[model samples]
Target chain A: MKFKQYLPASSSDGKAMVSLKDGGTLGDLLDTLGIPPDVPKLVIINGISRGVSNTVNAETLTDGDVVAIFPPSGGG
Target chain B: MEAWMGKILRVNLSYGDYHIEEIDPDYLRPYLGGRGLGSKILYDEVDPQVDPFSPENKLIFMTGPLTGTGAPCSSRYMVITKSPLSGTIACSNSGGFFGPELKFAGYDGIIFEGVADEPVYLWINDDEVEIRSAAEFWGKTTHETEDFIRAKIENKYLAKEIRVASIGPAGEKLSRIACVINDKNRAAGRSGVGAVMGSKKLKAIAVRGTGKIMLPDKEAFHKAVLHARDVIRAGPVTGEALPAYGTAVLVNIINEAKILPTNNWQVTYFETANKIAGETIAETILKRPKGCFACPIACGRLTEISDPQNTGMGSPKYFKGEGPEYETVELMGASCGIDNLAAITKANYLCNEMGMDTISAAATVATAMELYEKGYLPEKDLGLKANFGNADALIILTEKMGKREGIGDIMAEGGYRLAEQYGHPELFMGVKKLEAPAYDPRGVQSMGLQYATSNRGACHVRGYAIANEILGVHVKTDPLITEGKAEMVKTFQDITAVIDSSGLCLFVALATNFLYEEIQSLINAASGAGYTVDELVSIGERISNLERLFNLKAGLTKADDTLPKRLLEEPGGPKGDVCRLNEMLPEYYQLRGWDENGVPTTDKLSGLGLQ
Candidate 1:
């Protein structure tokens, strides 16, 4: 999973994608990466915005699920 | 009293007469200067039915109380007038040394009225204010005008202390989308305020002041300003992200969220959004970063594009300038389906040099591209193929728009007018004839309500509901939902009104995790005005209601407060969503104490002391 550096618990370099265990839920992946489940304002898995109902934290991640996490930052 | 200069400079261009007037305390109390004071004065003095270009229309330059007070990011000034483009009340603010210089010159604001027989510019050296002929500078670009004025004012031996606010050829031609450029790059860049200046034949206002700005409680003011700076520094957005990537950081984020408004908003996202993203710009064209007066976070991108061939663009093999801000990148690059960052950068430079609004100009071009793609516009008429992703054509079209030559005459009229001229009013994609910003309402649901009801005609800066809806600055809200957005929009609008008047950058209000109390403390300490946090919030609401009243009087009905049909009806993004404006507008009106028709009730006006 690629994380924007601004997000909490993301790698300092913001480019490393860690391999996760098979059938690991998104929460387990976040826990492995030390990211709090509630930190990201919006999470995208392969370009679609996942609502809270379909949050990455609860959804199980497959082998090739690419994730992008965003923080609460703004500009016009 | 200490924060405000407590005076106004009134200039009549027709008579070439200038006078200084003591600002009424009552006027300053409720309005509180800046946008609030400027809007109140515009509503009071100008007839709503008068043409925007007529001599009867007044142009007011206003600064906030914190301006020139050494407050962090406190160098913003507003240009308020009736917009020739949108026919709505226009208040566009710019940040540079000009605001502080005006305050230091012992005036809180300047009100320009009547029309000049010939081109002229205002020169202020302390109290010696004079109306000088600008016949020699009639055709100069904004950068040239500033350089010429500065050179004419000061000797090379002395330091450059003068600051200027000037218009360019775009303004000289009275393009409806012209902007007033300050410090060469920063602009009061919306609502055709520059056209208002051009109609009056005013070239620029150059000011030099050595006078000091006094703060009532200097210690408290210092403490408050320091604390505010600290708060800004502590935030992740203001402290780190902005300095690193500037505003262009949002390109990927918005694209990721699928709300980037690509190709005249026909789609929600662009395919090559990453090419023009902040990270890309930082890695490629960005040379350095800059900031306005006393700004702690330098979010301004001072960039250069040296590879024209690689950029796939026009003249200027090596270009150097500021910005191509997030809005500029989106509207000029992705929104037009031209992902060439250099092309967008060049377009941005043209807009700055020619004193044009990037959003308006680019959106207009995007609309033209859409028209051309649909066979409504012929390549023969355009002199070039304006197909989507035509980088070279984007550069040429931008230059033509700035010069207002050939087909650029129609293009210069702005997106709403351009779309209407092409026989497609519904394709305008704005409220009250003003073009929408980079955000697509179908994606960020609350932004639809914000743009629909904004007094300034489809401006995101008016409310910035994106703070809650997208960025979650204050709190996270479901971007796809309509519930609770009404209350959120109202609160954001009111708070934004306060911030706009308070002489602080809106970024502070957005990025800083604080409330009205800290802002009130800063204002009270600086001005010795005994205003509580609640009073400040009420004043914000009052200013908002006053602006709403102006728009209402100007013939903006509830019907005018609506999104484009596409947003209201069509599917958006991969999720196939649509803006629930109907679901939200009624709740928004109710929360605002407005009638079902969107007019504020008499009691609501009375409660705000606006009646």
Candidate 2:
């Protein structure tokens, strides 16, 4: 299985996929994703995450596992 | 008398008159104040047929009942006028300390009419008002104007915090899309209100008021304000995203939705969006977060752009300025097919300096670029080798537009007129005479509907339906859906009208008021009055109807409820489908209790208390 997330503010599209070894939970995957805790808002798996402890569905993840993350936005 | 000064400052330039008028209590109850109250006055007093740039047209700057009352984010003021760009009623709202200052100065509104014989600026201290010569400030930028006003006044007891709303060369040149800027680089920055001020020969408004502004119920208001600020600080949008990266953060999300207008609304996707994304700004250029008066959520940024070229190795000077807000980024960056954030920020400074609206400026530049590409507009017309992605064209033409010189002369006229002048009127992408924002309606269905019927001509603040379509706040609806958008647009419009009228910035409602019902509570807390969600929504409908009545008087008909040819006939993205504006307009009209032709019925008008 693989985990992918984007740091939108940095223009980092998270197009690079990370392969997770068997038996890794979302927490481990989130940890490996390496989003700094101090980075106020993170679009973790299409949801806002204040902490990296947010769980991802590592079990459902497979090769080419693509998850898009977004930061909070304003100025409409 | 607790918070509101309950007075109006009237300035007539043509006759050289300045007087103070007591506000009508009845008008305040129904309209609530700010943009809403201003719209009601414009609809009732002025003839709709009056020319927008004429001395006959009155420009009303108003604040809400809650303004300067210690209510959270109730620091915004509105500029209401018949827009020179749209030829319809315009209400552009902005956040700052000026609203509070005006309240302290014992006035609820400032109404100006007629043209002065020469350049002049308004000076208000408490109950005192004066119009002084602005010969020294005739050609200065907005920034310079503010500095000059502060320097000349030199009032030590006034706290050195005189808030000034002024224009740049663009407004003096009467560009259709000039903006009124204040503290924190906040702006009533959409329509041509700046041009109206220019036409009146007004240079700037400098206000200093020390009278304590109080809410009707100070204890209640303070508690409510605290709650609202907490909500703002706790919300994800305000707490995390905006504080971390400011408004420019939306660059990637809108691009992901594939709705970010790229290269003149032709492409939804931009490969260069990453280059100008929010994170890049925060990392490379962002210096510190800037904020408006009494706002805890300081989403504004004071930034400096330094690069390898500015390492004293290449350019002698580096660019430093206030922004590249999301709209400026998308409009100036992606829409014009320019991805450089530093370049976009520089252009923003130019817009502010020249008194231009970045949204309209970028959109017009894109229109001009499209013309150049089609060979309809010669390169010589622009006084340069004009093309998209050419940063030089963006920088120089902005200055020209400020001065209304050369190609900038025609470009300053706005997209619709510029296209009309070249005999290819279809090239213009706007509703009425004003240019559209960064969102291409084809991608976001509700936006298309909103733009089609917007009284002020293609404004986003009227109803920002994009949050639902793209950001998926509350409930996510498919961005491609046309059905039921009538209700969505109406609902969004009504909610926003209340927000604008209340004197709070919209960001508070969107990011802070996560639970929809909390918005009503917050307003209740500040006003010390209670209303069901229904009454608030009705206010929105009423404001819309009022604006419609004003526009009808301005000679707009069902024909005016239209999308540009490009949005209606040519869809460019994956679906290649044009906006079904025809299908949406009728439903929107029906929802607003209007006739099939988009005119407000007499009954509807009467219900809203319109004359």
Candidate 3:
């Protein structure tokens, strides 16, 4: 049911990845991955900022989806 | 008075009165300055029961003895006060020409007390200081407010460069994470101190001073400085990695190490981290190396992004500014699920210009995005569909939050409060109510403990375990194991307090001579004080205890020092990695010689010269 997977920037070309389950929002994917209800994850998709529960358009997964992700954060 | 301006200025907004008080040598010698001095003042002067945002809560902007001395990174200073976000002692340090300028202006610190009945700006010209009405400058952005103040002063020559620390509409509107930005974009951008300043009706503070500074031993000082300069230039991390790419380079490094937390910390890897990496950011937007006063490292980046969509007065790259450093990239880009170079750069610029803490604001928006995706908040409530990965919404929310308007209003409450308000308390990924920085706890185990006990909430700069976990600066360690991290964390915490209070940038931690023979050489040559490596290291320990004292006085208990539930419970990131905070906390307390509850015993405090 997972839609599209995103590889890590440091990955050798393409390896490590993250994906949202099909027809699932980001939060639901979190449940599937066992991410805590209160744990915060910063989600960046297509240069736009959103979080878990961000709906996954499965059809658009392999299209022009240039996404990034980071943990809850602060500037070092 | 030979080495110090020897006076602290106290401005009482509640009474519309101001006074100059002499700084005692007793306080100076014991606490040193910067965060150390600021901590002592807060511990002694502030009442624990007082509300952080109330006029009674004092915001102290303090510089150190070495500040303005042309010492490496001497341009640093810190703003210490009760933080609106964390409800603990918050000390957010910044670097630029401002700290030095404040020192030159014949003062050790500015102690802001009480709340102003109306908007105003503080004007300090050498010894002549005044509180001027700033109603005209109210709601203006930081750059504009500073520019307008100098215009009003009519000092002509000094007006153009009169260093100003100003708050924007975010502060004026009382955004909990609003920042006080100075020297264009060098910001003390954490913990909502700007909102506290704004609560005092203070728009900006303009300073121009020409007083010459006298060091304890000028000859020795120069020699030490020269030695440190060599250490910096020859050092691998400082000489090349930073000078070339800045902190943004960490994106690739950490991501490669598999500790780069992405998607609000739900994951430990960001596939597109390299897209907005330091090297790429430099190639695309970095114009030149920018520097703070006396800092040769010039780790700061001055950039110009040419994206037509992001071009305008609000964008930093529209003209130029300090940065979209690593943390900003993580917070504004990776944290929010945004992978666009121009978009994150634009948000970084806007945050700086509008006087906002990029970390908290990004985390807030990211939290809102998470919440919005969870159905806890509706698009109708936010006036827009703020689902995760909405780059435009992230940017717009950044702007709104900076102004404390629209959706920005809710986002600006910071991640913890915002999530709590939405009846989804567990979604807040913070320690001490301060939002966590990048680097998932699971992937980098020690980082979890580091964030848990950071003096200013969930900050990584306080004791970045990444040096060991990812970069292997000290030694390589399993990022997933909590085994011996307690001792390492305590050692770093102690040494960091020393370095931070000494007015040195943490990049020194990356210096090849991290053992500090070079710094030892510098200290001996300049101050004429023959200090061994052991003695020098002790300074860090001393400073750490002092900061702990301040936090203790502010009512932080061992219980208050903890990681968020997600890190502890969620097993999503790297293999079987959960925040081993509890595993390390007790050991950390033991290593710190504190009680089981993380409280510093009277004996331990006195042992460190708190006596």
Candidate 4:
């Protein structure tokens, strides 16, 4: 799996390659990355926003899927 | 008489006199001060077709009811006038101590009318007002002008308390992109509002007020304020991300989304964007985080550049100042193809000191660079090789543009005129006549429609659809899709209008779970107007329609509501999608209760009480 993380606490390099079982859910990926469940985040799976809320863990993930995680952030 | 000062100081420069006028109570709830109230005054007082530089044009400095009331991010004020660049209704909002200080000085706003025969600056110490000669400070930079004025005050303590809003040489020279600088750095930037002030030969307005703003229901106001503060403090975006990295945090995110405009929109992403991103600034030259009055987010950056090698040619090796906000970094750094953070920071300082809009100034230079690259602009006229990524050229051209010298003189007219002179208006990359900011709308589909319909030409803050389209704020929307974008754009625009009129920073909207209900509660307690959430939103619609009516009267037609040809026809972004403005505009007009030609229907105007 290809992962991009924008949270400073989660990943220092912002990009990572992870191995996941087939039919794994997004909750599994967050658990593996040691991301806290209560922290607000925006999860994008393959360029589409899965959710920005805490319930994004319900999203199902598959092999070769791209997941980008962003902290609550905005622009001017 | 709660929240609002309930008085306006009208200064007629031609006669060297002033008068105090009472603000009508009936206008307060609907207009709500700042942009809304100021625009109403402008529409009623000035002829729409009057030349922006003429003495007939009036410049208004207005503050909202929440201003100086200890409300979060209540440090904003609006400068309303006709834009010399776009000829549209200009209402440039700025944040600093100046707006609050003006309120404390016993006036809600100031109306500047007619031109002075000589350069002058206004001084208000409570009721003591004077139009002093500005001959000594006329050609000075904004910093120098402030210092000169402060030094002239015999009472040092009073001088220190005084907050001044002044123009630099750029405004004095009447550059189309010149902005008004307050508190030495914060600017009422964009739309050439400073040029209007310059035409009046009024250099600055220094105010020191000792009065407190009265509130009708202090207990209720405090209750609402404390709750809002808690919500803002807990927000992931507002409380943490913004205070930690400032607005430049978006540099990486937007670039990753492949929507960060680079090389003046010729490209959609910058490979070296990380060099100037917020993370890099935090790791490097950032001195500290700064905030305006009552601003918990503190998104402002206090930064310094000490490396001699990184500084631009003929610029200082060591300098400390307040920004290079996200727009500045993108437009002047990545958009101009120069990723040197130090150079970008120095250029930002120059813009602040010289009183120019960094967005338009940088976009104009980017246009010149493209013109030169295409062989349409001769090097003889430029006096140097104006190429993309030329840091020295960026700095040199910025200073020249401020002074209106050589090739900079042509650029001072703005990107539209600069490109039109070079025979490619299509290459200007703006709507109406004002240059667009840093976003590449081709990637964020709704932003294109936002840009097209903004009352002030091509402004992101007017309707930041990027919040939904890219950042996933409020609701996540597909950036590449056209479906439902029009309704989304209208809603964002209306909400934005309410925020702008409230004297609160738009960044507050980024807070997770914060919505119009919270805003309505704050406004009700602060102003004692008791508006419902829907009514507050309707007031925003009223303001939008009023400004649109003014623009239509100012000679703007449906045709002017458009993006650049490049955005519409040329493909860009990672997906190579062009901005489908046509797909969204008709629906937007319908949502706005406007006709197919983009004119507000009589029913819509009457419903909003504009009739």
Candidate 5:
């Protein structure tokens, strides 16, 4: 998986390359990266928002998916 | 009379006289204040086709009822006038201490009509008001003008309390992109409002007040305010990201999304965007985060540029100021393909000091660079290498634009005129003649519709679809799809109108819990208007239609409500998509109760009480 992390508190640097087990969910990736569960984040997989909700963890991740995680941020 | 000061000061600069008028309570219920009330007044008084710089074009400075009421982020003020750049009704909003001060001075707004025979500044100390000759302050920069005015106030304590909103050399030179700078750095920073101020020969308005705004129900208002503040503090975007990184934090996120417009919309991503991102600013130049009055977010950046090599001729070697905000960094840095943070910050300081809108100034420079590269513009015209990524050229051209010197005279007219002069008006990436902000609309579908239909021209803040499309503020939508975008854009535009009218910073919307209900509660508690959420939203719709009527009367046609040719045809996104504006426009018009040609229907107007 190709991971892009915008949260400074994340264990991984800005961009990271990680190999996830088959049938791994987004929560697994978060766990591998040491991202805390309580932290608010907006996750996007292939430009679609996997919103920061309880159901987000159950959303299965696929191989080669571009997972971009950002802490709550906005601009005009 | 509870929240509103219930009085407006009208100054006839031509006659050097002023009058105070009472604001009807009925009007307050419908129009609210700030942009809504100000736009209603401008539409009623000024001829739609009046020359923006003519004496007939009145300039209004307005504040909302929530302003100075100890409400969160209640520092906003609106500058309403005819736009010299777009020939449309311009309502530029700004935040700082100025608006609250005006409210405390016993007026909801100030309207300046006609041209002054000589340069002058308005000095308001509580109820006392004067139009004093500003001949000595005519040539001063905004910062210097504020300092000079304060020094002349006599009472040091009173002077310290003074808040000044003034234009600099750019406005004095009638630069169409000139903006009014307040509190040293914050600006009413679009649509040439400052040019209108300069046209009237008005130098500045320095105000100091030792009064308080009366809230009808202090207990209820305090409760509502506490809840609102709690919502803001609880949201990660408003409470953490913004306060920690400032608005420029969007740099990396936008760049990562491949939607950050680069090289003046020729591309959608900047490779070196991280170098100028908020993190970099925090690590390098950021002194601290600043906040407007009663603001909990505090997204404003207090920065310093210490590099002597970054300074241009006639500029200080070391300087401190606010911003290089997201728009500034994007337009001046990435849009020009220049990654030098110090150089970008220096240019930002110059734009602020000289009182120019950074978006238009940099976008115009970028257009000039494109024209120069294409051989459409001659090198002899600029007398410098106007190439992409040339930091020195950016700095020099920005200074010249502010001063209206050399080719910057043409540039001061803005990007559209600059490109048209060079035989390629298609190259100007803007809508309604105003340069587009940082986002490449192709990447975010609803933003395309927002830009095309924005009453004030190409403004992102009118309806920031990115919040939904990218940040998932309200609802996350697929950025590349056009489905349901019309409704989304319309909804955002209406809510934003209400927010702008309420004297509250729009950043409050970033908070997950701060929605229509929160806004309604605040308004009801403070103003005693007792408007339901639906009523408040209808007020926004009314404001929108009224501004649209003004624009339509000002000679804007359906043709003017469009993105530039580049955005319409060019594939500038990660997925090589263009803005499918056609799919959304018809739906948007339908949603807005407008006819096929984007004009509001008689029934709609009547329903909104505009008829």
Candidate 6:
């Protein structure tokens, strides 16, 4: 899993890969990592937004699933 | 014209007559310049009830005291008018060589009043202002118009260095989303400012000068400039990230927050954000980084798409141009659900050429796509399918919007009118007829209030609360809560008003380490207008109040200061799913010292020296 620049600095470093169980939901991983679930953030699994097959936080993560998290930022 | 060129050029195109007049120093002291001065002029000279396109309407292009003073990012000018789209006081700021050139040409600003009897373009060559017939250059694109006028000047000495501000076919056709573009890409890109120029049959403003600005305190100004540069260079965003990725650096960041506004605001996240993100552009398409005048933080992206299939121009194997910045990427890419960066880039190029506002243009198309998907709009009427994720459709629609051809005629009116025409006005993701730029208000809750109350209508720069709520640029606040947002929004809006009026890019204040004190010092040193931080803040407040007064007098009531129905009702992202606009607006009005109707009280006006 990779945390993008927008993630809270205290939560996780973008440089390291974290290990997780097979079939673990994104919410489960976030809970285990002590990441806040109620905040506005995007969950991408294996290069796709997590909502394609299931709710963003409930999407099942399998072996080798690449996950990344980011926060909101936009202006012209 | 001395110190700061205390002169303004008044051109009455109706009679092809113009005169240079001195601006009162008394007025200059209170209003400063740029947005503040422009707003004061508009409020005083033009009647609030007049039709925006009427001869009674006037367009003012004003620069600030710091402009042409070699201050960082000081190449800024403002175009102020009543918007044909929003029916509000509109002031659009642009950064390029034009503002500085105009300053060097011995004037602080130019005011265009009354419609022209024929097409004309203004030529300002160091005090010799001429309203030249523009019949030959009337139909040219902004780039071509600039080239044409620059080449037509009789003065051989300064012809090569002339700078131009122009409108293209979109503006010529009176498209409400049309913008005034300068220096190839930079634009006064909101509120139909270009259409105002077109209404007067003004093709462009060409300027050339050899005059030098005499700073009030040369040594102090230079020292402040250097300090400002150092401050920006030390900030993470201004020093590194922005230079590396341009404004698109926010693509993934915004998407990660699930506030990227995809599929016409129906979806909050886009799956292909990375493909059209800043990092991707830098790694693949970017040719080089560019910057505005005297700017050390070069965040402008210069790009080229090499694939022939991607360049909408059939035979062209490559296309090079200036941006599809974050707002363009989101509005033209994510909001339209077209993830193809090449198509978005092409659309961006077309917008620049057409002198159109990309945000409103894309928002117009996005609204149509929703109507099309819901079967409210038929293909027979559209001339093409506009399904979400259709990159080709995005390009086609953009070209159509620019030319105002076929169905483009209606779309050119902007999102509000387009949606209202289709009997689904609720589908229009906008406030006061102006489409909100990239950010989803449901994710960044404060932006909801900011957009609703923005004097120019749904603009981000008016009060970019996103910096605090999301990026933590100034102070980190809980994005999901409405608590303290009203006060935060008021502060940001006031400070931003100061920056906008000061002839400096707002990005420096938001993305760089240079804040209020540094900006105050720079303005003081350059213009010799010694002002405390509190006084600067008061000027910003006064400007905001004046704009509000105009809007109110023009008939916008408290009821008009609200977010779109969809954003207020629909669920969005994982956080507090809907925008808390109601909870914030009241608090915002209170903090602004306005009544429950969002009207500034006489006492408050008196306090700000407005009474």
TM-scores for every predicted model: 0.94, 0.90, 0.86, 0.95, 0.96, 0.91
Considering summed lDDT, which 10 consecutive residues are worst modelled in model 2 chain B?
Answer: B307-316
Q: Name the lDDT value of residue B364 in candidate 1.
A: 89
Model 2 local distance difference test score: 0.76
Better of 2 and 6 by lDDT: 6
lDDT of 4 by residue, B381-413 (tens): 999998999998988899899999999998999
True contacts kept of 5: 0.52
Error of 6 at B495 (Å): 0.6
Candidate 1, residues B1-611: lDDT per residue as tens digits?
Answer: 88999999999999999899998898789988899999999999998767999999999999999988887789889999998998889999999789999999899999999999999999998888999999998988998898888777546532387888999999989999999999989999999999999999999998888888888778888999999889888776787778888998889778877888988888987878889988889888989999999998888999987775433223446668898899999999988998889878888988998999999999889888998899888889899899889988788888899899988998889888888888887777778888888888888888999999888878889888776666666666778888888988888889888888988888887565656876787788899998888888898899888888877787778888998998899898546789889999999899889999989999999999888
Worst 10 residues of 5 chain B by lDDT: B309-318
Q: Rank the candidates by TM-score, best first.
A: 5, 4, 1, 6, 2, 3
Q: Which CAPRI quality tier does the interface of model 6 achieve?
A: incorrect
Backbone clash pairs for candidate 6 read: A42-B256, A73-B254
For residue B89, what is the lDDT in candidate 3? 81
Give per-model CA RMSD. 3.1, 4.4, 9.8, 2.8, 2.4, 5.5
* TM-score of B-chain for each predicted structure, in order: 0.98, 0.95, 0.95, 0.98, 0.99, 0.98
| TM-score for chain A, candidates 1 onward in order | 0.68, 0.42, 0.42, 0.71, 0.76, 0.63
Tens-place lDDT digits, model 2, residues B1-611: 34456788888888777899887766666676787889988877789999888888999999976677766676889999998888899899888788888988888889998899999999888877888899898888887888787777655655377889998788888888888887636788988889999888898998988787555566776677677778878876777678777887788767766677887787877878878877778777788988777777788888876653322111347655678788888888888888877777777777877788888888888888888888988877877876878766777777677778898898898888888887788877778877888777776788988888888888788888876666655455666768889899988888788888877787776663444355566666655556577767677778878888888878999998888887888765435667888778888888787898887777877776664
Where does candidate 2 stray beyond 4 Å? A1-14, A18-67, B154-159, B306-319, B512-524, B527-532
**Per-prediction DockQ scores?**
0.33, 0.24, 0.04, 0.36, 0.41, 0.13
Candidate 6's C-alpha runs over 4 A off are A1-17, A20-75, B1-3, B154-157, B312-315
What tens-digit string does per-residue lDDT give for candidate 5 at B436-554?
99988888889999999999899998988888888887777788899999999998999998999999988888887688999998988997878898888899899999999999999
Model 4, stretches more than 4 Å misplaced? A1-13, A16-32, A37-40, A44-67, B309-317
| Residue range A1-76, candidate 5, lDDT tens digits | 1123423353343666777899998888878777776554777676455567768877888888888777777755
lDDT of 3 by residue, B1-611 (tens): 54456788988877877899998876665555678788888877888557888878999998866678776767877899888878878888888888888889888789988888889888898888888889898989998897788777555898776899999888888888889999878889888988888888899888988997766677767777887787777765667667777788778656654566666776667778778887687768889988888877788898887767775365434466667888888777777788887778778878887888988888888888888888998888888888767788878888888876776777787888889889987888788888877777777778888888777778888887776665555555566678999988877787677666656666777765555565555444534445577765666676777667667767788877888788898874546467778888888888887898787777877777766
The prediction achieving the highest DockQ against the true structure is 5
Please give the fraction of native interface contacts (Cα pairs under 8 Å between A and B) kept by each candidate. Answer: 0.35, 0.35, 0.03, 0.44, 0.52, 0.15
Q: Which stretches of candidate 5 lie over 4 Å from their true place?
A: A1-13, A22-25, A37-40, A46-50, A53-65, B311-315
